[model samples]
Target: MRDTASPAPERRGGHPVATRAAARLDRLPPSRWHRRITLVVGIGAFFDLYEIFLGGVLAAVLAAQWNLGHTARSWVIAAGFLGMFAGANVLSVLADRLGRRRMFLVNLGAYSLFSLASAFAPNLSWLLALRFLAGVGLGAELVLVDTYLAEFLPRAVRGRYLAYAYTFGFVGVPVAALLGARLVAGHQLLGLDGWRWLLIAGALGAGFLQVMRRQLPESPRWLVVQGRDAEARRIVAGIEERVAAETGQTLPSVPEAENVPERRVPLGEMFRGDYRRRTLMWWVFQVLQTVGYYGFGSLAPVVLTAKGYTVTDSLLYAALGYCGYPIGSALSIPLIDRIERRTLIIAAALGIAACGLAFGFAAAPWAIVAFGFLLTVCSNVFSNAFHVYQTEIFPTGLRSSAIGIAYALSRLTSAVLPFVALTVLTDLGAAVVFAGSAVLMVLLCLDVALLGPRSTGRSLERI
Candidate 1:
């Protein structure tokens, strides 16, 4: 029999609240609530990805208008990455302390407000400054997505759920490319620059998202970690009740608790003991990943323009080729639950390497677009798994901080990579630039094959 004064001791999860919350969450079937959360959260990510890609298309526009070289345009891109570095490292910490829902709202406002202001920028200097400020919110918003979803989802379908949401986000790439194809054609929209109109459109979208976010519930796991036992139970109970109604069946009994005590864990804890090794692994992984991802995404159109395609052809072809991103990522939805995450990551990395090499060597436009499409498909395949892997490796108390710190380090590399990619593409050529990317992908494949954890179908606490 259980003790009357205190609940049955859950040795693994440590606290009664955490044990109950995790049990209930893991046992419930997917319901309308799950889809609703995924849609709202995914929409926020859609806007963020759209804006990030828009920066690239807009860079192409500004390059001609401002008579800017690839090197100068790199600074325009670098400013956003540098600001994201600060935002991810700094504001992300607040999510752990202040609460996820509040920080989510604050970051969205920060990003959209600055983005709207950027539309009015009179010169390159002002545009750069506004983009940098917007990046602060951009950075934190990403971390929160990973943090919230990991906590809300059940272990059985967590990986697939994230992929579904991420699929929605990857669509933003093609959408941006398509929109840019139309918007970049002229300065005829109320006499405002097309790029300015693009920025304003993104800001308006964020405002609509802010209203949608009002219905989101707090993360029960986070509440449990904060020692707010009653609140966590209430949230979990409400969710369980809804799931029961949807399934028309009785809920499963709570699983045996994993005993992790409720205590105040300090930030420094992630850097010591077993987590020390994990932190080092994630930091290296993130930095290399960002260099490969941002380097390619931000500069693909520019490279096409450099290669003798007319500006119109470059943007249009880039749009056509990037249509593969969302489709490729959507492929992962069926596979994520069946395949081990580390295994899938390694496989996708190899595909990226192969496709990137082909893209670099192809001289014909058809070949370039064909190979570029393949590369993007592989990248998004890699991305869906990669985003989920980082948050899975850490404990709840340190989850946001670890992701934030590693993400910050990654953004730091991304901040520098625009300049690096520009220099390499100019000095060496596309073949050599992608050769470097291929090598990085090979290294990532090996690292994961050797050091990465097995996370599929495992509880967040257990992983």
Candidate 2:
């Protein structure tokens, strides 16, 4: 018989001669290197949420300063989603072609510069333009981070790790909201508008994160795919060594037999093969969840105010609602691995529907706050589960593209949501808006329950 013990086919560089090097990705306990990488990537994601949340908080300020009508204000709020639509589809493809780390850096730098420019916008039109541009970078940054995190972690802990990674991003929302409330509530700074100062401050923070991210290494898995096996080995070994040093546990060697094929499937292939049902299921799931999520999230204060609360009361209630995000995200970390993703998604959708309807009908401020908090908690739970689910459904070859396309659809729907909200609330009231959202959520839950695949602990390749 041929030598059964021969070394697996080595790729270029000193890496073991393995066919599917990515499948054999080294797994180790969390180390300083892993923590540092998570921090850098998580901070980048934080800025992305900060930029988006800041816009919502500043909308009222912009309306007063710019003399913008409700329609015009909705336009400004919706513009960023337009940019997100373009960026997710375009840059995601480029990310796969270039590299996850490279695209992430480019997006961070671009968004930071644009966000700073937005602080000085002379008019509403200019501000909208700048916000749109900044959103392009924001969109790409979100997709690339998910791609990078999925590739960096092992399959065993991927669900929990990704959920934890996303918690950092959600944490930024409340931070932005609290800070924006302080900045825009009254005090001006050195002849600059407080809202403008807020945007500028966010830009500066983003730039700081960009510098830190520069120190992060590219995903070793990506390097292996590019035929840089020796470099991949070095990077993985470094991670293993750091984890060993930190956790006092020896890292296990990767199994040679677990290597996968390296062929890159085209983006179109996602809709044709084993991925077809998942693609359709996620597309519907994302669209409905976003309409429910952003519809309430972007307009929380406005909705509260519409229900006869004072501005201060509305802001306070909205703050309480936002607090549920981090709580829900944290709660999902342990549950994501324990429960079926589809089951959690379906339950979350139903909860969002029920709680949203209750909040819509409640007149008392405390009642609305309580119901809104429940709705927000459920919405975020669904968000965390879906985020983990979407990235896990695709192989490394098309992970970014598939996720980006689904995310783009969500943004595209969100781009139209503000106008939809404005029209419906103006004609039918907040109850109708919430009631309709409930219908959508219920339908989506049914779709996911009936058609969605189970992907809780499966590998991307197996999915």
Candidate 2 lDDT, tens digit per residue, 274-341?
A: 78988888788778888788777777766765677655567677777788777788888888888998
What would you estimate as the lDDT of candidate 1? 0.80
Q: What C-alpha RMSD separates each model from the true structure?
A: 2.7, 3.5
Query: Using Cα atoms with residue i matched to residue i, what is each candidate's TM-score against the true structure?
Result: 0.95, 0.92
Cα deviation of 308 in candidate 1 (Å)? 1.0
- Least accurate 10 contiguous residues by lDDT in model 2: 1-10
Q: What C-alpha lDDT, on a 0 to 100 scale, does residue 412 get in candidate 2?
A: 89
- How many Å off is the CA of 351 in candidate 1? 1.0
Tens digits of per-residue lDDT for model 1, 1-463: 4311123233433445676677668877787888879878987888767766776787787888888877778877777777788899888898888788888898888888999999999998998899899888888777888889888988888888888888888788888877777877565588887778888888898988988887888888888789887787677777877777787777666676566444456999888988888887788788777756666677778878778876667788888778778888898889888988898888888888888888778879899889888888888888888888887888888888889988898778877887888789888888888889889978877777777788888888777
